[model samples]
Target: MKKNFTLIFTLLLCLFYIGGNAQTQFWSDTFEDAGAPSSGSRTASIDFSCGGPPFTSYFTRTLPTGIALQNGSYSLFQGSKIWAAEDIDKGPTCTNASISANQQVTWSGINIAGKTGLSFKGLLAASQLGGWQGLNFGAAEDFLIVEYRIDGGAWTKALAFYSNVPAASPASSNQLYLDTDGDLIGDGAGLTYAFTEYSANITGTGTTLDLRFNCFANASAAQELAVDNFRLFEAPPVVAPTVTTTAATGVGAVKATLGGNVTADGGASVTERGIVWATTANPTTANTKVTNGTGTGSFSAVISSLPAATLVHFRAYAINSSGTSYGSDLTFTTNAALSATTSQSNVFCNGGSNGTATVTASGGVTSYSYSWAPSGGTSATATGLTSGSYTVTITDSESTQITRNFTITQPTAISTATGSQTNVSCNGGTNGSASVSPSGGTPGYTYSWSPS
Candidate 1:
């Protein structure tokens, strides 16, 4: 005969951790205060264990020996009830009086496909078993087994709660989970146990997540075992998220739009995502960065104040638990400011309209369209002439434009003199006047009258 609670430090309390990452809780159950079974099933076995079998009934319609209960009452963790397997001598409910043995309850069809960092949590408690003393046939060997499996894979142990047999129990300590170094728990100090929270992690992948809870108790002692409040969670992976960089779009003088798409979260949520750029071959967040925002998805940001006609290398990035991850290196050149120059011929005569102007445009978007204010000409080359200041708006395919002004001049004609005279209105009044108007040469006029 062996003492119970061989897994006190492991299955009962816990030794492994699920890390500090936050988890996504998906399901939970607090074993309602539902009425007890009308009759207990799963007869106790001559042996004991999670896989114990070939059970042989020692009693029929068994009830707890101590703690009087007329109708029996099942404890509740959430509503007013809990899943409990009372001691053999007494039934927790008035309905079921038979002691439970080699029995288990299962929850099936839980979908967990593509999910990672899975963890299971629950509550449990147990009373003293008689087997520790080696006094009678009912050595305390009853326990609880909680386990799960993915996509119908082999059932993996998530958590387990065993009968508390103590560490220093008698010669029957063989069943005390003795294999693993330092696995034995308790100092045989207390005879009873209290409720404690337990947790376990489920690593790997599967289509459906399934769970099972097993309880095995006998009628030999006044002890009992109970369970409540079961919970499951999916935590973010500890690895970096997967992301891809998109080519720069809307490249223009002084600014450009950069973006990326996050393909996978790497089992974790993306805390940040964005684009980084620099004139160098490989740019990092340290250079110039545009924060699109948090989370995984397609995002874009516009980097401004960039020098024109310059080549820049950039990359997209995402942040998560495992740190930062970047997309492939990408490069682009910003458009230079649009510009133009005009070559012209002065009007042949001072007031001639035959003067011509031709434009040679460079930089900015390709396709060009020219609009001349005075001539109303649409082509890059304008004719028909005019002796005056004119402005041509040079526009590119993207609606970007530039203005240039130039003057046309003709050599001053060999003084073509023309004069107008008015006879004196009043004979000696000196009111008569002589004037000359000049065209095409420098624009202003000057005259000198000799002795009126």
Candidate 2:
């Protein structure tokens, strides 16, 4: 019978194990290439007769809520084709597509059926950088935005800046970002996004041109910021960017020291501000934080309490006024715990000297302590045992300790001797005698007598 029961239990366990291996299900969508659409593939036919550079109206959905700039033949605003120094630079005169307050302009249009969006491209001179400062974008309080017109209806704001950002540096080097890996917003400096296509949702378009670059405090004068290759097209399926953990060492714990760089192309960042740890990739936003956002750009945390054998994964992120920018993920592991804990099942029994038992510990214990109480225990080197309640405590080399508790019960006493018997002959003939006794209690006894 016992063998049959064991076999049945094992078969049930096997069935449960097999059930756990069920595969997860998922689905995906595909789209035609924007670069070269094949037969039956939808492509925006653009006419450069208005100016140079062909326009591709692939992304036609309304832009996300942010600022935008337009150039090339698709520019909705007049005079956008010409590049002039006095039109969009810092100094008194703004020039080029880098709109400045001095040359402020607002363009508006309708989407009017068909996926006809907008597009533009140009170059910005490295010198024209406002350094860490940028020209005002859209309204001061609101994000700079690109609005689209669908079916000739009212315009709506599209595309806005995201949160993550890289440290601000002088515009000394040129950089490029494409939508291939992710959204093509320039790493930290610029960004790009697409809208849904084919839907009658979009008709015409317009853009707010207020964001421009101004010189930093230390500047000789104004420089040129250029822009070009702008267009709207059918939105495409976004690819998830790959995230990897890279650290100074594989050590789980990171030390507080001079700062280092963590990089990722498609927006990346460490989730929190304090020192945090995890064995998984892409930890949620709650795991870590270094300095609690003092704006010092330093990442540090305290984690001496964690076990040495455990591993830690970390990532860094930068938050711009708009949204979050993420960096690559990093990972490390600790040595292991200096000590561990063990527990014994709670025990209940009748009060008796034979109830005593010793718990054996495998790990070498440096100090053996004990505790005893009705329902609780304390830490002490040795504990004298009693009846009603008891507990044990043990401390290890790591200064960590564990406690266990048990209880003892006493049986009720029974009464014999009937009603009091009257004294027969003389003083107290055959005086009634009564006695009381407790089991598994103190070994001593005392008594008192009274006359009736």
Candidate 3:
């Protein structure tokens, strides 16, 4: 009873496991709380725009001490808490919600004290939004930071810049750079600056993405940065896939054998690779049908029973973000069935004995038919065949045939003969002719007589 119960439990578990893996149809991303600032949690603190709310909250440190928010506006003064004495002029004014010459504000010391730099970053979940144009930071002079986070963890710096200078002047390029190779700040003089663009490849499960920015201040603090244009808009997604096949030996089956490899890349995998057959001599196509498994990188399937004259073909394909990629067709053929043969030793006879001939079939032949013709006569096994030339033809079940021919000669038997003289050849004079008779092998023959 216990054994039966255990078997039932195992079967149930297997069914449950298989049922849980529903095929994924459309891909999607889990929505994330994108409004948070570069630092603070409850209210996004990173000041996306140089002159906006939820702005300074995103900043860890700000320059020009006496910085304050009044009536939805910020005031910057040399003596203010967020300000420094080196600020060229005290409070710059934002009139009609527009930045004027004096309204320009820079956050210094952001990169100083070993604090993480500021950046502007963007995130797009595959499931959520589509048809995004591109991401834009403020003009070059704004000297903003752009950074991104994967699956919402720590903020990694993406790009950084210095003040493009002369606010309200023609725009210059943003400056962003790493410290040569290390993360630590290098010597203050001649430090490389640049505005960088970065891309992230997401794999597995998590979908939420995060971004932040740090605005650098002026030369006064040598520690500040600035921020501008903090917002999120969709950007085009990325696509690239790789396809490869496994190592294979030369096809050896009399009938074409099918085999293949696996595919990857472009966020896709192989569903099937098709194989087919053809019959034309040196045929590229024609009378073809899929012989192996379907779709994807690697798989194997027989083309069913094939004739010796068949030529087979193979092709592969994969589905990815960019649609399907097709592989070039390759072909191999079922080698023609061959017939092989071996010759039997020559037949030797002593007087009038009989002789026989024998031959063997090789290769793919299941059965063999043999016929022989001799210098003497034709026979199935060629028995009692007198000494003479002979030939044998063998046919295989496949109908392929081959022939061998040889010669046979018999040695003559020893001969014994006797001779007699007629009546009387008395006293040395030959009266009558002597006669001789021969028997065996040489038959009746000639003879000569001499008397002394």
Candidate 4:
């Protein structure tokens, strides 16, 4: 079998940063306690010009009974106390009191100076009386409007809703009606009283602002509008991407595969992601790095031509509009190259002994363990009788092994002898005889006598 000499090592580079960009809560109210200064109240009369701190007694409207100021089974409102307009307190002659009795709440002098943007989230639902039942009811006259004044400037209508408005009501550039069921009235008898989420982006700038929520019914009786979980937030700065590193895979002595994942892009988009590596700890983009591609998610890259048997640090990283982020640091070392040399001794003759072979290794960890095939013992040198093939295996400290082969051959032997000859007269024929001999070789050797 052919042997492959490639060695592989992997070091995981996890580069990461903690914390992230988050939105700041400028104000929030659950209206669990009507007595709390932050919790606003409802009035039965209309005073369009009345502006004061929330929950303060500044309005002159009679507090109606049907408009429950305490918490109840209303699924729309969060917590205990929800501001609801009901028909429980109607006088013997009262009907659709929300029209004749106006309810309004105000938050005054709110500071929102260098905020990027403003947003609000709340639950809102309107029940209709004397209109189409279920989600199809059309109570176009019932109104809920939100108005805001920046730095005490002229009040501008930010949002408005009319429960009975038709689905095709003319789209107003400044008004947004709640169409929870894609109908004019968001709630009806067929649909149990359930709250729906409402959100809007606050536009325009202000150092000290005033916000108002006003609701009233035009001609319908037994109608109610409930609001809860009101919150105002200041948009935070752009956020950085989140990233994590995966384990590295070694391809060979000098190459490995690095990987990572981008879990989030904070509210911005991720523009770049990949791996970075270096010889020291906490490798960053300033070190050697690879760009897998843009956007958030999993990515991988192959690193090559790395030094052998050296510790390396690496990590995954991602970049977004807010900034760059990295995973934790990881470490790995490459495999060392192995090399060996061998020497062999030949046997003196066929079936003779004294054959030996020795091996030496370099470029590997020290205190190496040695082994020889065919029972040559666990030593660098192997000595025994007869000539044949031999192999030596050496293992380094890291358990990496290298094997070398050597061959011992039989030595060739030679000897010669001159023939003894009787002295013969120059021309005496049969009286002269000569013989020759050879040894240390196969028999039947042929020899030629000199001057013959």
Q: Which candidate achieves the best lDDT against the true structure?
A: 1
Looking at model 3, residue 116 earns an lDDT score of 17
Better of 2 and 3 by lDDT: 3
> lDDT score, residue 73, model 2?
17
Could you tell which candidate, 1 or 3, scores higher by lDDT?
1
Candidate 2 deviant stretches above 4 angstroms: 1-272, 284-291, 303-310, 322-328, 332-383, 393-402, 407-452
C-alpha local distance difference test of each model: 0.60, 0.31, 0.36, 0.59
What TM-score against the true fold does each predicted structure earn?
A: 0.45, 0.25, 0.32, 0.51
For 272-358, candidate 4 gives per-residue lDDT tens digits of 899899999898899998889988778887777677678878899999888999999987887666678888887765568778888
Consecutive 10-residue window with the lowest summed lDDT within model 3: 124-133
Give the per-residue lDDT of model 3 (tens digit) for 25-60: 122111123322333232223222233333321132
How far residue 451's Cα lies from its native spot in candidate 3, in Å, is 11
**Model 2: per-residue lDDT, tens digit, 31-77?**
21232111122221111111112211111111111112232111211
Model 4 Cα RMSD, 1 decimal = 14.7
How many clashing pairs does model 1 include?
A: 21
lDDT of 1 at 105: 64
Model 4 residue 402 lDDT?
Answer: 82
Q: Where does candidate 1 have its weakest 10-residue lDDT segment?
A: 47-56
lDDT of 1 at 162: 42
Clashing residue pairs in all predictions, respectively, total: 21, 91, 65, 18
lDDT of 4 at 82: 54
